[model samples]
Target: MPDTTRARIQQEAARLFVKSGYHGVSMREVAEAVGVTKPALYHHYADKEALFLAMLEGTLAGLSRLVQAANSQVGIRLQLDTLVYELLASAPEQRVGLQLASELRHVSPERRAAFEQEYRRVWVGGLSRLFEDAAARGELRGDLPPAMLARAFLAITYPLVTGAPTSDPQGTARALLAVFLDGATPRQGAA
Candidate 1:
């Protein structure tokens, strides 16, 4: 189903939620923002948390596809570069939707757990496969665990993925890859 109203609700709600945090945005505000009556909005979503979860789940599922496609490239380095570039290339609203996962603090514990399962299954699991392969091949340095390595990559680059204007995504991808694929320490041959 095209379901434009539902999609619009998610889009508008995302913009509102991004501008104002989970607690900051309310159902009435979301309804107003979406130009839908409270009854209409409630028809689509049970309540605020459900709407929030739907938005988050939808974004994460799309991102999971992007990550999988990026991972199709020959090597992990190329994949990482593509992944960061793809994310940076995504619309601000979409990036904000991805970042909204961090706002799980306000939702019920059950809701939080549900989102966590989807996040881990869709978002983190998409990236974890690369590290798992790399580790199996003994390509990853040190004692890095596959899942931890994936999480570390997210920890390092996500701020840029959602924050301030990025003048150069390729350059940004390169810098992030440098720190993640390489390290902050000086090269062995550096002066």
Candidate 2:
């Protein structure tokens, strides 16, 4: 079907873009990777920029939905667990997003700015709200600003979702959350 071909083109383009940076990969390469002709690819997306932007948008939208779902959960632990698991479950796509994100400098300034703003609004803003609620309930460690806490959480989890070598995503997510919530030092209790 046409829809299936379009989706395949998107997926292949994302993988190629991640593997060979945006500037390095050609539209022909993407078409070949997708087993489509250049004209067919153009029919799906006007240009490489259009295709790349579409890929980025899809990745961000998926992540936003995941974070929103996690946010609906009651407890901080459950929220973090669900967020991490869902993110890692889509690690391949997330890596493509991460790759494109790092290469945003190559995109037009206006487009880059818009993408950055939406990304922050979705990921950072969502996390900040969650952290704020947790802090209010004494669920967080210290009095750090919710925005800062959100950024820290993102930094901690970035590599995990991107390309970090992790044999066990679920276990890694749990350990990372524990270290995030409890800090490096153990609590005053039986070992």
Candidate 3:
């Protein structure tokens, strides 16, 4: 119930979840990691599924805010660059969001659907709007549909976030951005 207990549980559970997949860790292991009894952990979270969802919700909330903030900025190029950096700069713990995303199919149908819906609503929908706005302003090529282009951009960068080493995340991010932008930008005279 206390703030510290809740924070500790989230911190420990996130660590264990990243190190071991959601199905791999048990309540007892989380309890030991947090220095709390199983009953204490249960008091805060009804079950492992509940705790996993909480961690997932928190990660998505952070990412959604980041994307929304970038979208609100003045320029589309800046907005895209900001999103790239945010995704690339995510810490190892936050990287679990990508892993969990891939593993969501293994979760219960209800939770899996819910996760996918929220992901689309937040990340995909936001990206579509950004591309549309950019195209309207002549900041991006107008030939491609915003929704399709948004999906393409996400497809290009998701792998780097999920599996690439952190040694040069920024560099990888720049290259990915360059590739997408180069294709999306209209040339001066090309039809």
Candidate 4:
């Protein structure tokens, strides 16, 4: 199997897996979509599970890089803003990975566990460190646990990526961050 063929297969398979659920797609269909023969696809990935895992790994790797780059900067507000904008910009690609993660339980228990562990190590672990750094810097509210705050932030802002009608994801992200950083209610101290 040539490296280019394998890469092509992985790219196309990831796209299809996002469009259709894991169970909804078949190896033969992937091969056809990639314009490769079934045997050629098999030569690269012995089975659908192998292909799926490769796609998951690639997605996780991309996400890990995105988070790490954002965390490398010091300011909590800047970090959060960078993360929000990147996530919103990459929503379509990320949505596929999120859908796969949500549906991972349908995979065999052993593989599912492995997938989950990798997800935690890459996504959750990095997030935990970033939030903890923010707290240690006294940039975040002391009353909130960094991990809890990180999850809440993600929950609150992710919808903008999926639901917002605007063309500017970055602008939408900045506004969403304002809501999270500030509050829905008017400040009592305001004149």
Candidate 5:
């Protein structure tokens, strides 16, 4: 199959899944959304569960690669800022990703643990390593464990990307980073 057709199906499915819960949407709806026949959708994905799993995995794997790439560059603050901004910009994908976390029960029990592990490995695991690296370099606050700090950082930023509205993504990123790094107080020598 061609890349565009497959990509369109995935994109449309992600949209539908995000808008409607896992069980709410059907393969027929996905096919109609993608302007393809039901059989064509099946050619791309065995079933709705398979399609959802693929979307979730793709999102996590993409995030892992993104963070790893960002970590290689200098300036941890800039890295975090860039990451937050990018995540907010990709609202659809982020929504789909978060929705998958809540709706994983729809996944088969046999595959559930493996899928969750994959999600952790790509998303949490990658970010945890980045935080660990920052801690080793004395770039992160030493009060909290690097793992805890990473989780906190994600918790703080997750809402911003998942569903929060932002007129200014950069400003929002700056505020979030400041809060995550420095708490709510104004830094010394600031107005």
Candidate 6:
């Protein structure tokens, strides 16, 4: 049989996890929300923590794909502008996993470690590559670290959970790009 049940489980479970903190929801509730028996949910995920980890992994993978697409752009400015706009334009529910950023403590150390590794490798590493490539081309300041620049770039997007999805992603993209690039660009006659 197909694993459509797994997909259904993830959708319902993500809603539940986003609605309630990691500790606030239970396996039974997830099963109930998905209209499946506890056994069916368990067959897909070992436990609540496992389900949460899966959600986090999916979120990272989605973001990694976004960054990968942005890399095809010729310039760091275009790559970052496009990435930010795409993220801001995304459905709020699509970011539900990351929106639960504060609840990661409820997850076990081992699982958290694994997710952190993947997060750094795919998400942060992907953004860092954009800056790294730009720095190699002398398009950005070599005096600063690309990872630091990448983190600064990402910090702007963290507040996304509180606001409505952008009605004008392009204008927002332009405004955001101007702010970021203004700081990131090198100074010609600095003492």
What candidate 3 gets wrong by more than 4 Å, as runs, is 166-171, 184-191
Enumerate clash totals for all models, in the order shown.
0, 0, 0, 0, 0, 0
Q: Which digits, one per residue and each the tens of the lDDT, describe model 1 over residues 1-191? A: 24999999998888888888889998999889878899989998999999989988888877887788777887788888888888887847556776687787888999898888987887788788888887676667648777899889889877886688699989998999998888899999999
lDDT tens readout by residue for model 6, 135-171: 9998899988999998988887766534677778788
* Candidate 4 local lDDT, 84-121, one digit each (tens): 88887888777667666666766779988898898778
Give the alpha carbon lDDT tens digit for every residue of 1-191 in model 2: 46999899888877777778889999899888988889988998899888888888887898889888898898888898889888887887788788887877888889889988998998889889888888788888556999998889999999887776578889988998899887889788949
Task: Note the Cα lDDT for every prediction shown.
Answer: 0.83, 0.85, 0.81, 0.79, 0.81, 0.81
* lDDT assessment of candidate 2: 0.85
**How do the predictions measure up, each by TM-score?**
0.86, 0.89, 0.85, 0.88, 0.88, 0.90
User: Compared to the true structure, candidate 4 yields what TM-score?
Assistant: 0.88
- Which is the leading candidate under TM-score? 6
Worst 10 residues of 6 by lDDT: 93-102
Worst-scoring 10-residue span by lDDT in model 5: 141-150
Clashes of 4: 0
Angstrom error of the Cα, residue 158, model 4: value is 2.7
The superposed Cα distance between candidate 6 and the true structure at residue 164, in angstroms, equals: 2.5
Which residue pairs collide in model 1, if any? none
Q: Model 1 segments beyond 4 Å from truth?
A: 186-191
lDDT of 6 at 179: 80
